[model samples]
Target: MEKAKVYYTDMHTTFRENLLQKIQRLMKSAGIETIDFDKKYVAIKIHFGEPGNLAYLRPNYAKAVADVIKSLGGRPFLTDCNTLYVGRRKNALDHIDAAYENGYSPFSTGCHVIIADGLKGTDEAYVPVPDGEYVKEAKIGRAIMDADIVISLNHFKGHEATGFGGAIKNLGMGCGSRAGKMEMHNAGKPYVKESKCIGCGSCIRNCAHSAITITDKKASINTDKCLGCGRCVGVCPVDAIKTLNDESNDILNCKMAEYTAAVIRNRPNFHISLVIDVSPYCDCHAENDTPIVPDVGMFASFDPVALDRACADAVNNQPVTPGSRLDISEHIHGDHFCDSHPETNWKTQLSHAEKLGLGTQEYELIKI
Candidate 1:
């Protein structure tokens, strides 16, 4: 197979031709104009950071992408699935509020914000993938599934469980409905640790299947009835509910790859990954630690797998910065994510993505 083209640009420009110009160039080189966007619903998936975390991609970057979509006559909207963790982005209402608070409003990005899954995260369309290893079908958010095009604007960064959250993570894990996310994260029903339960009934209220029962000053989950949406786990006030670790990290990454394929199935898609603000953890965390590396530039590609592979290679080749979280860790390696989190193997995401026919890991990095 021919290597997919992954266009890149470094942080080497003055105010005259800044990163935004580079972004435009990168997208053009990557063939962003190839898609027919007239009258299309373009869903630009992105992570709006938890309110206090400052490491997420700036809304200006989103505006650049939104402008490109608008220029093509696409009706673009910035979107993300409601997070499974208890935080400001747990539901559509609060998620939009956090997005607006963080400057991702229509005025800033030239598009409205929509929680891909509806109000309580139950709105989904089951997409069948007959060749899937872990999941035969993926429950994607309704708005996301219904869109004519899917564009991922990812803030490439380190992750605790997935090694790194790049394009595959963005689509697979990011695009899944609350229940689909649960399926990718765990292979079984989620449980409530009664000892940690505050009996606040937050989990009960969030469970779409009504699997959680609260009485006697505690909450207990009925496994038989639970669909394992994982909303309960995120809604608990005290972190009482938890998804059991039934799947291996390798399997989880593979499942994520399959789910990602389900998301882009039969749809025109584009991807862009920003390697700046290389946070040591996912933006889901309220607090972002120091960056592990210097600001690498932006990457754009039609092939998400190749885009991620190129980004990971770029980060691996760079020298680690001193006084960062990566520097503090005694055991070091060429790969920053592995050096920071030794237990995770990030390659599983790419290898599995290839297996699912999402795209090839083999890529040619074309510098802009």
Candidate 2:
């Protein structure tokens, strides 16, 4: 495959052109206007940081993207699916609240914020992945699938499980509904936490597969019968049901690539990643440690895989921040993300994505 074009611009800004304007310029240079967005619903998929994590992208950046979309005759909305974990973003209501708390309100982003997966994290579209080896069908958030165009506005950073979080991470794992996330993160079915079970038959009632049963004032999940749809995890009022999270990191990356393919397949999609913050863990954590590397810059591309590769290369090229996590750790791999997260190989995601014809890892970085 030929090298894809990945446009880039550093964070350095002059008084005349602020960071927001710079991002807009970057997007334009990246050919965002090429997409015919006439009165179309465009989903700007992003991670509205966990309530207490301050590293997520700012609302101003979202506004810049949304404004560009609107100027191109599109209706844009900032969106993300509810997280599978028990956190501020576990459900739509709480997820919206978390977005709002993190300053992602419409008033700030110049667009509405939609929890893609709906109230209970159950509203989903089972998109078939024809080339998938691990996931035959990806359960994506309904709101995301309903959009006419998809845009990933990602906060590129370190990830404990995936080495780094970029366009693929933002679109694949980020777009997955609760069940889809469960599928990516778990190799096995969910189980009931006996201590948390209140004898509430909520799980039993909601289990379409009859995988759950209440006994002795406690809930138990039958692994043989469970489909791992994660509905029981959502309906359990007491949060008794929990996923095993047994999927190996490599398999998790492959599943994530398949999920991303399911998401952007046969759709007009674009990707932008800001390689700042460079946190050593996912934004799903309520707290973020200091950035492991100095702020790099912003990147945009039509090819998600190429975009991620570019961003990763940029981060790896930067010097490690003093006193940060990467500074103290042993840099055995000579790669920033791998040095930060020894357990994960981010290349698996890009290679699998390329193998599935999502996009090529080879890219031409066009600096603005």
Candidate number with greatest lDDT: 2
- Candidate 2 steric clashes: 0
Report lDDT (Cα) of residue 352, candidate 2.
95
lDDT tens digits, residues 175-199, model 2? 9998889999998888888988899
How badly does each model clash, as a count of residue pairs? 0, 0
**Full-model lDDT for every candidate:** 0.88, 0.92
Best model number under TM-score: 2
The residue-level lDDT of candidate 1 at 314 comes to 89
Please give the range of 10 consecutive residues that has the lowest summed lDDT in model 1: 228-237
Model 1 misplaced regions, further than 4 Å: 195-219, 225-241
Tell me the tens digit of each residue's lDDT in model 1 across 160-225.
Answer: 888999999999999988778888878898887778888887877777787888889788988899
lDDT of 2 at 13: 87
Local error of candidate 2 at residue 324 (angstroms): 0.4
